[model samples]
Target: MFIFVILGLLVCTEAQGISAGTPVFVLKGEDLLLNVTKAVVLGKFDDFSWKCNKSNIVRFTFNDKGASPHYTGRIEFPENNFSVKLKNLQEADSGVYTAVVMKDSGDETEAKYSVKVQDRASLPLLTVSSVSESSSSCSFTVTCSSQDSHINSTFTCDTRTCSQEGGERSEGIPDTFLQVYQSSGSIICNHSNHVSWTNDTNTIKDVCHQQDDPEGLSVCLVKTCVFSVGLIIMVSAVITVHLMEKLNKNK
Candidate 1:
């Protein structure tokens, strides 16, 4: 079996050349899989080796296991598998990864990957605009925007509740969401991406304050008009009476 495995590894190395694929992005402190399982294989490969930036990472020998001291505690590989799992990743871990496989028949294949470790999303910014309010209710528009341009959403709120209106979101990427609530004439905006969050609050009391009823104001105005008209009529009647009295005395 040892002789056959060595023969297979030699043949595979001669037949296969290095190939690269699209780059992959992973969040820091997240798990990453260096995948190499897509190639067509005649049978199960016995010898597997993984590398980082062209430096040896780990290898499964027929009789023993070997791993680089740098990745001693942070890597895992299943028996006879070419793929590897890296756990608790860090920013410094981003680099080129390569996987090599050798079959028992001396045929080999290679797979390469470029990795990028990204930081957690930053605190989002919530902006409020187009605010219109009345004595009984308030209406406003809000937008939750992120500096990364990966997240952007619009929302609308009233005294009762707030709801999502429209927005843009990234595909195949983690999403950020927004929520709004009203309390005591204030609107609170919350922006969250599961890992981080931020908030913006605004008060509508200046624009939407408790107000007297419209019917009450109309009634008061009507009462004043009626009183003024009645007083004018009474004064005119008294003047006419005095003028008639003077004319009679003069005659």
Candidate 2:
């Protein structure tokens, strides 16, 4: 029973080690530092190796360190620690990396990391689809987009404050998203991924005031036309009254 229990524990430990890898995200063309989570003692271990997708990339003995030829100029292995600095990461370089240590007694230890490389998100586009005005508030619909993703949302603003209405609608792209939200009296459209983000913005007050300009000009023109017509009618009535009084006096 004691031997069986020890074997079961070892199996469980190995399973946990493989499944509980740390997750790291880096942008394409950037560098990353993969740190070893397990403590290392160079004197206690006979060999150390770092593997990617089960293929060895670096190996270390007590006195020397070497890397595979494919990664010779792209990786830096420091002597003071077991950390590896990967330079100019590409999307193809994303994979599970494992650090394996072999003790002199033939026992093995491992630390695992899962790395992802992503591109920076594109700039978001924002446009007003429609606008309506009332005595108390102004309401508008806006569309925000980036690459293949888009979101549509509505905003209502009064003289002092603004709020979103009917929530938001969105279509997403893989590994990226579009979001519309309000901040500091401005509506912001943001496009984002794990690596980077970009945004576009417009002020609520400015949009509402622009919509008001045309309506204001129309109102001014109507008032001026009414005043001019009334003045012409009054002048014609006075001329007819004067001509009738003169004809009656002459008769």
Q: Give lDDT per model, in order.
A: 0.63, 0.81
Tens-place lDDT digits, model 1, residues 6-117: 9999888755533444467777899888777675333333766777887788876655568889987988874345567888889799888877665766735477777777
Stretches of candidate 2 above 4 Å error? 1-20, 42-45, 103-109, 166-171, 210-251
State in Å the error of residue 38, model 1: 7.3
Ten residues in a row with the worst lDDT in model 2? 210-219
**1-251 in candidate 2: lDDT tens per residue?**
99999999999988886785777889999998777866787773488888888888888888888999989799987547778888899999999988888776674646788888988888989998689987767889998988797778998876666779642535476667788998876889988888998899987767886334433444566889999999999999999999999999999
lDDT of 1: 0.63
Q: Say which candidate scores most in lDDT.
A: 2
Model 1 TM-score is: 0.44
TM-score of 2: 0.69
